[model samples]
Target: MDNPMKSSFWMLCILIDLWPYVEDNLTQLQCNLFSIGPGEYFRSLVAQQKTHLWTQRNLCDSPNDAHDRYISNHLFAQLVDRHCIDDRGPIKLFCDDFRPQNIIVDPTTLGIKAVLDLEFTTAMPSQFASEPPWWLSLAGPDSYLVRGLTLDHFVEAYMYEPRLDQFLAAMEQAEKTHPAAEHHKPLSRLMRESWRSKRFWFNYAARKPFDIDDIFNDCLKDGNASIESLDEETRAGLDAFVEAKMKQLKAYDTDCARHLESAG
Candidate 1:
């Protein structure tokens, strides 16, 4: 693993080997691990994270913020309904805080000795693991600062990263020879599409919580559509959903502040 490409290729191989065992271990507890239950847990977690970040950034007042929120929720709900919750496929382990800093490597060989920081790791839909890791580009969502280039731009640029091709090639070989070739094939296709469509951002946002605003806005921009394009009935429903969600977030924040004040 002297080269980054080699290291990443090996990482994917390890992940493929671990996928089945992790899914088997977590299948029973998946429903009970999160307070809201497995199906709704990620959704609720994302909403809570987005609410906190939105409040912290004072983004609630931005024009079209409500629309953005609505679209974000809408897209998220659709994804969850279609691909996430209730999928019978093997679940994959997701480590939210994975980055280069968390990886321990042998200095001479550059081989990965160990991966640390599994504190936030949990089982999630296999499709999640199918998407490319954000660290493949060695950049986070916030690093794309050029006016026109956003997260999608970073993903597109990273597509040409030498390591990604190596990783995918390794995955393809695994698909052909692995006992779980059927499983690996679908994930391989998904990873490619996720990269091409930049759906990786949506998957990332679904888990990152705090990044919902930035990711959602970028998604809307990529789609090249606006709130006005939504049908009248859909718009009405989304408006109502946004209003209620905003009110709930404000109340939760106010309660937390009052409790802090009393403690002080």
Candidate 2:
């Protein structure tokens, strides 16, 4: 099927080329520059050659890093032409699997920190039954300037949605061996429990906790993923649920603080 969007994009580019004076509009110039032609020649060149340039320039020796840089460079180059902000970086959209968050403690202050970011923009819907990538400021110590393991790297990791099965398996293992195992639970189980636990407030209930599983399976049927990929709609719904739950939890915490202050 022809991509009407792609065709429209090319048409816009041609229009821009025909009227270069329109370059006065920075945004229009950006769009024209990034616009992939009908033949996709520039895009192909970036995919095949300039990608190697980025890889070599960055000294990205890892196969994964090289591939990610290539994609990022192509996407970024497109952004330069279109003058659009592409928040999704190379690592986030390319990584295949991610491990469950293992909390790290700051030795000096004894502060416990969770690695997962509270907000993550998802792609490919694979994180439905698994824990998404988390961010970490340090590696369980006061270490600084680690190679590519910074807060920025953490956010980029989530762009490449990891498989649900892989996330689930990590959660299972984490629940067994992680120091904070109590915080670990399968994503599906967590959702069901949250639904169950908040039934009084939400004023709803599934026939059983297992019903959530059935619903997930049914949703997956229409989705273009393996057993592990979450459909975009499902992921979005899950994100909404999470946001609501977070708000509820915050309210409860506030109430508890008030009660304690009054008691004291």
Q: Estimate each model's TM-score.
A: 0.59, 0.17
lDDT of 1 at 260: 48
lDDT at 36 for candidate 1?
A: 45
Q: Supply the global lDDT for candidate 1.
A: 0.61
**Once superposed on the true structure, which residue ranges of model 1 sit more than 4 Å away at CA?**
1-57, 145-149, 156-163, 170-190, 196-199, 220-234, 237-264
Estimate, for each residue in 1-264, the C-alpha lDDT of model 1 and write its tens digit: 297755665455446444554465356346556544444655655444434433432335443576676666555544454335244566668777888989999999999999999898977766677787667677765567435466666657656346677778888788776545442445667787876665676677776554566776666343655556566776677656556557745665565556546645
**Residue lDDT tens for model 2, 142-216:** 121134243233224433223334554666676566444454544545534433333211111011121222222
lDDT of 2 at 182: 57
The residue ranges of model 2 lying beyond 4 angstroms of the native Cα positions read 1-167, 179-264
TM-score of 2: 0.17
